[model samples]
Target: MSSIRLIVSDLDGTLLSEDNRLNDSVIDAVRRFRASGGLFTIATGRFGPSARPIVDRLDIDIPYILCNGCVIADRDKIWEMAQLTLEEIAPFLREADQAGVTVLLFGEDGIRTLRSTPETAYFEQREGLPCVPLNPGDEAWTERPVQKVVLIGDMSQIRPLWDRCRSGYAREYAAVQSEDHFFEIIPARQSKGEALKKLMAHLGVAPSEVMSIGNQLNDLEMIEEAGIGVAVANSHDELIRHASYVCRNGYGEGVVEAMERFAAIGAGSKGGNTYVD
Candidate 1:
């Protein structure tokens, strides 16, 4: 018998398909997992405005670890949240702007941008969320305290910006690239690992009884923290190396493979579909 009782995954490149969409296989697996007396959660850098659509599609009652674990929402209850201090956010945004980076601020209410551009519009459309555009001249928009700031740009261009900030502001903010095209900034004290630990405690489960899967740099913390860290074929090299097992398949199939290989999943688990890779 396996000791695993919980499974957490990252979205975007990790769980979302190449086209940035969630497939039926992933949905079925989640439903089945929940039905089989297991708990499933999404741990991602995405804030509520961007992560909610994916959550709605799951159609299950489960907590979501959002904003790179700075925020944890258990349905109507908010168990944990750590917002970046105004002092920290202001200087960071200033540095990013000076570095020619596009900054998107996320709050409990919605997402805001330092300046509205076609790039931000595209992101809002892609994620199916509304973004409040910030006017460069509106000092208030630029100065508002925030929960998190998402910097959107090509990695080649953003890397330099990140390097500059990192060199001067180590551990001031948890800087992570949730995707190749974007970087997320959150409070340094928070992480998917800490959020999972809290979730396990709240649910009365042990850390050794959790299994986690992810495929990106931001996923590294939770993956390393979990007792059984399973990386999909598409996972980053470092994550693959750190995981206890590497799934042969990628995407949803990879998730299926891990569950079956580890004997933590079974047929007739939940919904109308059983995961078989």
Candidate 2:
């Protein structure tokens, strides 16, 4: 049997194809892996409502990471959550809004925006969730706990905010670039890696028994935390640098390649460090 007891992967730009759909090979491989007594799940920046369909499609029963690790839950219940206060986020919101950047707030209630923009509409359509308008002065919205804050804009507009957040709030919050136009903020010390650690403990699995695959900077920590870290062919340069193995294939193909190389079903021994073509 493979030493890898669990496999966690990122969604966009990693497991999902460019068209934002799962490839058949990926589905088949995951089903086979699970059937062989291996556990599988995803760690993504998407929320429960948006990520639920993917989980259902894969038929994963384990708790998965969400909101870039601010929340962990399964279809039936939330196992863990980390939140940020309005005070912690208010300044960044003001700066982003003043700069004409679109901000999306995530909470238990749902996604909300201070003001609607083309980006807001796109986000709504893509996530299949409405971005309800919440005035800056609204006290009711503040009553809800926020799991994450996302700022969407061109790189020119986002870079400054990302830099400022990193310099100013590094001690209190984690600022990561989920995409070229997407800057995300979650509580400091909370990340896909931290959440994965929690899940490992819950399942009584050691770090040496885990393998993680991802393509973005937000996935860095989880990749580093796993026993085998894989970077897809389309991964960010920095993430590739940290990965133990870099795949020649991208998207679901890369996922399948990694599984075949590292977690092959019924393999008597663990796989080696060779890259897949």
Candidate 3:
């Protein structure tokens, strides 16, 4: 697949509609893209279980980037993982709890939390994974390391903590705000760009042969790294400034527009629906 075009897209606010569902057009577009010998996969902040359903729905054959790139997996197995120890997370749990932010822990064991909050409830509903109650003092996290630690809740509750984590934990962690209220904490070395490079090395593809789309801070590095970086109409201002092209549409429509742009570019045409940054 070294000679094939590799396309990696973000899920929420890029591939999914504003309503958080994949539209029929995207499904067909992905199928057509793969049918045309393109490698299609999604790089998302979601864990495998959360991202797997869509991967299965699209019947994607390529390995997908997950957990904000902390994990890489395909339908049958996990290809790579970067983990954090409970000792590393203990400081976070204490600080976030004291700061009144809700923390969601991701591990090989699934999502574990101190208690179910409205934010966690929304997460449960979205990810289709229940929060296994494991308080700060619980023994469950003591022996095992986690893949990622995410903070989700109101902005007022998460922002100051985000700032603190950025300043105080910069050396030990990579803190990214995936959404306004969703702050993800991973090992300092992990990111979608690095993971994409790893995948490329594994498959013998180069950065110049890959195309990626995203709309948030977490997607920034990969957007800057890919040969063709795309930002949707509703993407963060910062991302738009760095993107190689901006899609005329938003969400799933933007996804369709991007693949169309890819098709156009493949056919030796640069259409007006996408603009150079």
Candidate 4:
């Protein structure tokens, strides 16, 4: 029998379809898994503004790793969270601005941007929330520190800064790219891997009993940390190369193939709607 009890997956390029909607096929797959006494949830870089609606729509009853695992939450309770203080990222903000990177700040409450930009609007539309403009000098949210920060801009502009920040800021954050256009900064002390470990302990499961799948650089640690790690076909080369298994399919279809391969999750596990090459 498969030791897998919990299955956590990332959103965006892994679980959601190319159109960015959660489709029936993936929903059906998850429902079947749940009905079979399996636990399923999401581990996404997104927070309440974005991740929660999907969780509700899918009726996911399990805790989700959010903000790159800076917080692990369910509807009523936030089981875990890590705050990034102004002192911690103050230096990076200056460097990012100097490097021509636009910033987006995330907190438990909402998202804020240094100023409105096409990037901010795009992210806002995707998240189904307004990206509020930031006025750091204002005293309104001084005590409300952020949990994660996104630095984004042109690939040429941000990549070199990312390379520098990756090493120079290593001690303060776990910097990784969620997409080619964006770099996410999560506190070094926090990660989806650590959150999964905590959840496993709480459920009385071992490292050998969990499975995880994701596509972005943020997903790297969690994928490496899982007992059975899977990657979508569309994942970055770094993750795809490191994954225990790479799905022939991508997105929601990839998720289905992965569950079938690792846990034989559904009765007709060998069959699904065709979306693979």
Candidate 5:
């Protein structure tokens, strides 16, 4: 394939470690690669604010494709936006309430949930985040349009919810399983692959000029669209099988390894360890 100029990545599982923090090696490799003329950015299911910490750690100033491409942000400014309509989400929300499943709403104001139950509290604590209870006329929900609808609950309840929503509104929304007990609903037209393509086109780069690394089903589409698709060592079976190359390790180390392997040509060496940081 042709040379790559951009590297898009998934955040939680692919780039960040189990502790939810960025790895030093990944940051260094990205800095070295960018310094050598490549651009890097995040493609995640998280809201912009939620992704900012990792972005800051990487020190990348490029526009971020967030909320599974529901929105793209550049230096805190919105570059593109897509969101599920209130009508589209209302039915799902009602269903969750009836099923006693926990629902979390993410947007510009951070994370807001319908009920701050133990389950929801566990999520908030796991992420070291705060949970806002949905109060009628709660300014947060009313003022901020949702970028993603996250739900945490048992398989029996969540499965039926996904089936019900997917059966009825699949045309308007994309129902993705972020975890065994977690499901996220996004706008159907929005995806990291589509957002990456748009961003590359805007920058005058072709699809064959990009490389993408990820480790989840969501990252599969982005990988399929890029010239070189790198899956981390811990990537799911399908992702590993579909990827053009598989990294030697997982998380930050895997990302660093991929960059070192692919960027060597641009730097004029065979997988050189030239990362300065």
Candidate 6:
């Protein structure tokens, strides 16, 4: 029997294709993995609502890590959540607004923004979730629990913001460049890796029994946390450096490759020269 009891993947650039749809092969692989009594889930920078469709499509019954690990939930219950108070995120929000960067707040209920831009519109269209207008003065909105904050802009705009966050808020929050155009902020010490640990404990699974696959910097921690860390061929250089196994394929194809190599029953052999230090 395979030692991998669980498989965790990242969504946008790992499991899903560029168009944000799952390949039939990837779906089939996931179902097969589950059928073999192996658990599977996803860890992503997306909010719960945005990720729900994928979860349902995959028929995931286990808790999924969301908002880069700030929230952990299944279809019916939320097992863990780390939130940022308005005061904690207000500074960045004001800066983003003044800098003409699109700011999105992922809350417990849904996503909200002070204003919408073409960028946000594209995000809404892609994620299939609307960004409700945030009422700054409304006590109800102000007091809502915020899971994370996302700043969307070109590299020029995002670079400065990322630098500022790293310089100033490094001790208080985790600032990760999830995408070339996106910088995400969550509470300090919170990460997909940390949440994976929590999930493993909840499931009574050992670290050595888990495999994690991802393609971005935001996925670095979880990749490190897993016993078997895989990075797709198109992954960021930094992520590849940390991954124990680097796939010859990218996107969903890479996921399938990893499963066949590590998680499949009676799996044997490295299949090729896929591992790198």
Could you say which candidate leads in TM-score? 2
lDDT of 6 by residue, 35-99 (tens): 89999999999987788888988899989999999889999988888888666456667777778
For all candidates, what are the clash counts?
A: 0, 0, 0, 0, 0, 0
Cα-based RMSD of the predictions, in order? 3.8, 5.5, 5.5, 3.9, 4.4, 5.5
Any runs in candidate 6 off by more than 4 Å, and if so which?
Answer: 135-143, 165-171, 265-277
Give each model's whole-structure lDDT.
0.76, 0.85, 0.80, 0.79, 0.76, 0.84
Tens-digit lDDT track of model 3 for 121-182: 78777667898867656665755788888887676777665675556553577778887678
User: Could you tell which candidate, 2 or 4, scores higher by lDDT?
Assistant: 2
- Residue 227's lDDT within candidate 2 is 96
Please, what are the lDDT tens digits per residue for candidate 2 over residues 168-220? 65357777878768888888888899999999999889999999999999999
- Ten contiguous residues minimizing lDDT sum, candidate 6: 268-277
TM-score of each: 0.87, 0.90, 0.88, 0.88, 0.85, 0.88
Instruction: Give candidate 4 regions above 4 Å deviation.
Output: 136-143, 162-171, 267-277
Error of 2 at 185 (Å): 0.7
Scored by lDDT, the top model is: 2
lDDT of model 2 at residue 92? Answer: 65
The C-alpha stretches of model 3 lying farther than 4 A from their native spots are 1-4, 136-143, 154-159, 162-171, 265-277
Judged by lDDT relative to the true structure, which candidate is superior, 2 or 3? 2
Tens-digit lDDT track for model 5 on 1-74? 22778888888778877656666666667777787788888898888766777777788788878888788888
Q: Quote model 2's TM-score.
A: 0.90
lDDT for predicted candidate 4 compared with the true structure:
0.79
